[model samples]
Target: TDTPVWVKGSGAASDYLALHDRPSITELIATKKAAEVAYKSSSLTAKNIDLAEVHDCFTIAELLATEDLGFADKGDGGNFASQERGLRNNGDVTINSSGGLKSKGHPLGATGTGQVVEIFKQLRGDVEKGRQVDDAEVGLTHNVGGSGATCAVHIFGRSPND
Candidate 1:
């Protein structure tokens, strides 16, 4: 069974401060901690992972994702982005090659599952259009809503026999 945790960072200033001084920092730390927990709990390892479909809602989100996903350290995600390694197909961790909300149309009602559809296609080699990851066996998705009010993270894989 998968247990999803939703961390919010909105509402009155009191609500915001109660969680943390800065939502971004809280999100960053929480996301990183979540990744550490997930990575350690699962039998799957990062090197064995092939690709990811993260919520690069803003350009900054993309940078944060690299860190959150354990592909890059806290401050290194931006540097990874600068090298074109942050989210390219051949990058260290192929991320949001789907163009994310940046290019992919974000239909509010379907955005979360939409990211899954993209990852499913990518992992199964079912995508032939722009930004398809080559032979991706494992993939991940990160979804969030309204400045971290709601978030979901998922990991997917393609079995050899599938």
Candidate 2:
């Protein structure tokens, strides 16, 4: 399940804060609520997650992502980053270790797949860099556009049949 909200305009820096008042906060709350519902209604378990690739359009986005994905709590993303809890090759839940839009690159048409590609490699342990999680069996991806105007989130893992 997914929830979408509409804002007034282009959501600039000041506009973003005014509109969402800490987008990460909103995302964290949503994430937790979603997880709760998912656990009670489905066979999925959060502990099964092994890694993630998020829309790190900027360093700040990476920070916010961990919380949004339930990897950390509100306001703890920065601390997690500082402590290197989301880096590839390290952290419990690797976030954007692919360099994301911040480092690797961002191709509009291929942006979504690029993010997924990283997740695919990480989950398959085929990554080539300092950001490879060991034996990642599950992965996630967060894609957003225009300062969070639009977002598409997805989860991936090794299927039992695979």
Candidate 3:
């Protein structure tokens, strides 16, 4: 454990169980609520994150997550995706460096753990060269369930003080 990745903050939240009951179709309120708590606890905003692993059960889910997680403007996730702004080595904050849930099939309960492992390796500079994120000092993982009714966010950093 020479290269340690610290868990700077963690947050979880839940909203209405039924999707139809939520206020917005394009946003996951649970994610926003969870992110707010995580950011406050970590004293780090979305702008401080260098990389993020988000739940992408569907193509649109990724887009929504980007917006809900504050990576993009509320309606700009499409542009973000089209511009490859979330792609590794392509943007300010790399999204899904592990190829995400789409590329790496959703393993039921193991998805979030897989994300943490990806960030760990990336922060430690131990991932495959092509897959590694350059100097990733901070990372985030977003997980959601129950059709966006529930969410969990965790932030990590290479330094304890970060």
In angstroms, the error of model 1 at 161 is 10
Inter-residue clash pairs, candidate 2: none
Tens digits of lDDT, candidate 2, 37-59? 43333344455556656777777
Ranking by TM-score: 3, 1, 2
The list of candidate 2 runs beyond 4 A from truth reads 1-42, 86-91
Instruction: Put the candidates in lDDT order, highest first.
Output: 3, 1, 2
lDDT of 3 by residue, 5-89 (tens): 9999999999998878888887999999999999999999999999999999999999999999999998999888777454454
Q: State TM-scores per candidate.
A: 0.72, 0.67, 0.95
The CA-based lDDT of model 3 is what? 0.91
Q: Which candidate is the best by TM-score?
A: 3
Please give, for residues 72-154, the per-residue lDDT of candidate 1 as tens digits: 77778888777755434464678677778768666676776888787777766678766677766667667665564445566
Candidate number with greatest lDDT: 3
For candidate 2, the per-residue lDDT at 131 reads 65
Please identify model 3 stretches exceeding 4 Å from their true place. 86-91
Higher-TM-score candidate of 1 and 2: 1
Candidate 2, run of 10 with poorest lDDT = 5-14
